[model samples]
Target: MPELPEGKVTQGIAIATAAAFFLLWIAGWLDVASLKGGFIPARVSGLVQVPGAVPVWLTPLSATLVHAGLLHIGFNLLMFVFVGRFVESVIGGGASLILYIVGAYAAALLHWSMDPTSTVPMVGASGAISATFGAYALFFGRDRTRGIGPLSGYAVRVLWLASAWIFVQALIGMAALGGVQVAIFAHIGGFVAGLALARPLLLWRYRKA
Candidate 1:
């Protein structure tokens, strides 16, 4: 493991996320929120527009705060709280938060790039949460890692983990409950960001030391 810094529990993202779910639920506007806040590629590309849709740039962030069902939000928040808190502890609050926000944007771009014309709204935080999961998978794994070709062991590990994760997400996307299609590509984009950024963020944490 990388040497630990004096870590603190920084869980504002997770807390605020849970709060968003609750607040939206109580207001009975989750469905309405989804229609307005969800990241719809067509809306962004100007191929289609909804009158109440939030700004294209902001949809990525807003999308993370809404979900399709109890299972959706529950699973997303569970992974986020678990993975994010650990990453935050080692890298501190700001960097971890950046990981999540960047994850959201990356996810949106990937989803948009893959299906630029789709009018379906992609909602939920699974994509954003995948970033923290990627970091966690990278930093605290077995040391038996070996590189293939020009790739470093760490890079290889990232690729392998990403492949496995993408596969799993593919399955989830296919077998999603109640026909709620999972955003596999979005998850991929965010996970890649986490894998790419985890070490840099770690180095950033102690750069002056």
Candidate 2:
């Protein structure tokens, strides 16, 4: 495994990334007309019916870095600040970056699979963050998990919590019920990638020790 960079370095990079995204979002919002290139090409173009051809502008690789609007950016950044710190602290900097990219790509792949004709270019770090959430649940737990609710004395194993969450997401994703289009699949993809990637590193460390 690569020698991952320590805390501050990775944190700084993450902060800078968030900042750039914010600036881009602001610029796009201020100029509304420029929104064409901003990230909503799929929404703008009726080309959503295209087969397998992702707009060059909205490639899965670049989608994570883009955002739909200020609200979108704000929500994603907040989650990043909250979950990213602990995740980075536990996993090394390099690994965290890898998780972000892998999660984002995995989420996009899943989305593409579901909506092959959707020229609707998906954007935002939600997919990556969702992956982080998955990894966190695996490394940590649901009850001890803060922010969702009052952190009293909730302690559920990672696997159990993760399974339950997945079930909930499935129920919500069903749409026939009341769940909205929240990209639950992206979260799942990111999570699976995190578990798959993080497991080996964790196991290796245990063996080394």
Candidate 3:
């Protein structure tokens, strides 16, 4: 098991996110929020119009605040709080927050790429949480890859993990076509962002220390 972070931002985020979903659940406004706050690729792409929907630019973060079901929010929060603590602990709260915000946008971009015409709204924090997962795996997971060609051992490992993650997301994305509403590409993009940015953020954090 890993140690907890000195900061409480991660926990607070988890609580706030969970609370947002629960409040919607209790008030039976889940569908309402989904329509208003959820990320709709079509709307951004100018292919669809839905009244009361948030501005295209804001949907990424707004979508993260809503969820489809109890199990959905439950699993997403579980993954988030678990890896988030360790990642935030090492990276510090400010960096963690920046990572999450970037992850949300990255996730939204990938989700949009997958289907530019999709009007089906995507809601949840899985994409954002996946960024934390990527960082956690990089920061904590044991590495086995050695330096290859001009790539350092760490770079090689990052590519390997990213490739594997993309492959998995591809499978999930293909399987979900015309069926479920999972933002598989969002997960992929967020994870890649995390893996790629973790090192830079860490260096920046400790540069003066």
Candidate 4:
């Protein structure tokens, strides 16, 4: 495992993001912020008017910084600290940031495709964190397949793990939606983006090194 200090840029971003979410909640601006910053498929698709001054195109990025509640932010930040730090340590902060942003956009695009007319706002860092998990799995999953059947190679193992993860996410999404809506497609999109980007980033990192 890569050892990242507390003050690493990627870690700082994760902490700062969590702090921002808490601050918004404390200030009673979470609702307003979500309204303006959360990713809304209808807004992106131009089927609905944006409520605030922020541009619709920017919501996908901004939405990543917002969270629905304490549990949402807590889980995201925990994953960010654990998975993101390692990814950043391996690939460097720039690549980590790029992965996060790209993952968020990818998540938004997938969610929009799945439900373009939905009025509910989508907000969370799960997609970005899922991207980190994808990269992590690509880098470290082969050795960790303890119970799973033997795989042909690293790629196949990673695919198996990803498939299992997606299945779990689907189950979680169904349960979450039963109480409060969750964007399961966003998680899938982010994980896919991370999986797609990880090898290239690793190659680039190696070349640069």
Candidate 5:
């Protein structure tokens, strides 16, 4: 067996979170935890109330740690292992964690705003991982993009990529929603948040250096 960024804090978080998810599933507690921890737009928007030890308001944040199923967690963790490792390596662990957390909240807020009265609970790390993708794009998009800084060149490419990603996500969400819940808005929100934060993180890293 080989190690994949084994010592990094951001990577550790992803592994630990995935482990916890698996453990919960093995213990038959995943469903119970998800119901209690998953973010529900109606509850978040005050359109409905849920009684629990953990406040409904906190579900948005808590929901990021839960996943709908094995495949869901697997895909999210794979992305986290690859993209998250890169983002964390570039921005440092603390900034990476901040981006993930902020992205989660942003995603939840957007999802709530879009479907304020819906009672469905949203769960998974896709939104947070999407944020990492956004950050990765901003950091590396310039190389792939032709031209220079802001407004033209790499910026245009980034914008196009982001738009295409969102569009695809929207389509997937529409197609999957009837069978399985897909928080498309959450992914968009998180990616936008990551894109927005990427520059600031870079600047901060530079200043620190």
Candidate 6:
């Protein structure tokens, strides 16, 4: 668990995810001017031939890699770097990968169920990252992990930050008041999945002690 090399930290899972997202985005750009890009949507932007028009299974998977812009991917990657590593280390790389996949798909499915006709091409990994937070809560909730640097003491000293996080998401989902349109249901779905899946794992750990 030593700190990974600077060049290789995000190489395997994170880089792959980022690469796939960008590659699809390039293809999308080639298809249309200012109208194309396969990124997941915070809101419903009906322009492309989304998986929504095709099949249900594709919705969740497709949404994870899609992004709205460079900034969008940046934010997702930022979350992935900071929180993803902890979850990955705990669950093991394979299980962490599976969790992200499940979280993304679950979020997308929830979104689709809520708004089937809305044409917004879903994009970004926020939902999946949210899942990481959820799992982190269940896994490390006993001790408040402290934070350093710019955000400093603001982030690290909370025992139930995860609950607060969920509450904020609920508010966002219910109101949609945020200037940017977000798939709030997806966030909820991912959070729920993370908590549910992690519960058994946590319980088993306690039993082993």
Highest lDDT: give the candidate number.
Answer: 3
TM-score of each: 0.92, 0.65, 0.92, 0.88, 0.87, 0.66
lDDT of each: 0.84, 0.59, 0.88, 0.81, 0.80, 0.62
lDDT of 1 by residue, 1-209 (tens): 44543323336776777789889999999988888999999998899878877888899999998988788888887777766777887788888878888889988999899999998889999778888889988877665678899998877888899999999888888888668888889999999888988999999989999
Query: Candidate 3's residue-wise lDDT over 30-112, tens digit each?
Result: 99999899999999999888887788899999899998887788888888888898998889899999889999999999889
**Candidate 2 weakest lDDT stretch, 10 residues:** 30-39
Task: Please count the clashing residue pairs in each candidate, in the order shown.
Answer: 0, 1, 0, 0, 0, 13
Weakest 10 consecutive residues, lDDT, candidate 1? 1-10
lDDT of 6 by residue, 53-171 (tens): 42434546655556666766787787777666766556555566667777887777677677666655656677777777678766666664556665534244432454677688878
**Steric clash pairs (candidate 2):** 48-119
- In model 3, pairs of residues that clash are none
Residue 208 displacement (Å), model 1? 0.9
Kindly list the per-residue Cα lDDT of model 5 for residues 143-207, writing each as its tens digit: 56566554777567667777977998989887984377688889999998998898898778789
Q: How close is candidate 5 to the true structure, as a TM-score?
A: 0.87
Clashing pairs in 4: none
Q: What is candidate 4's lDDT per residue for 95-189, written digit by digit as tens?
A: 88889889889888888999899888899888877888898878766475434455456556667767977898989987884365778889988
Model 6 TM-score, 2 decimals: 0.66
How far out, in Å, is residue 129 in model 5? Answer: 0.9
Q: In model 4, how large is the Cα lDDT of residue 5?
A: 45
Model 2 C-alpha lDDT versus the unseen true structure: 0.59
In model 5, the worst 10-residue window by lDDT is 1-10
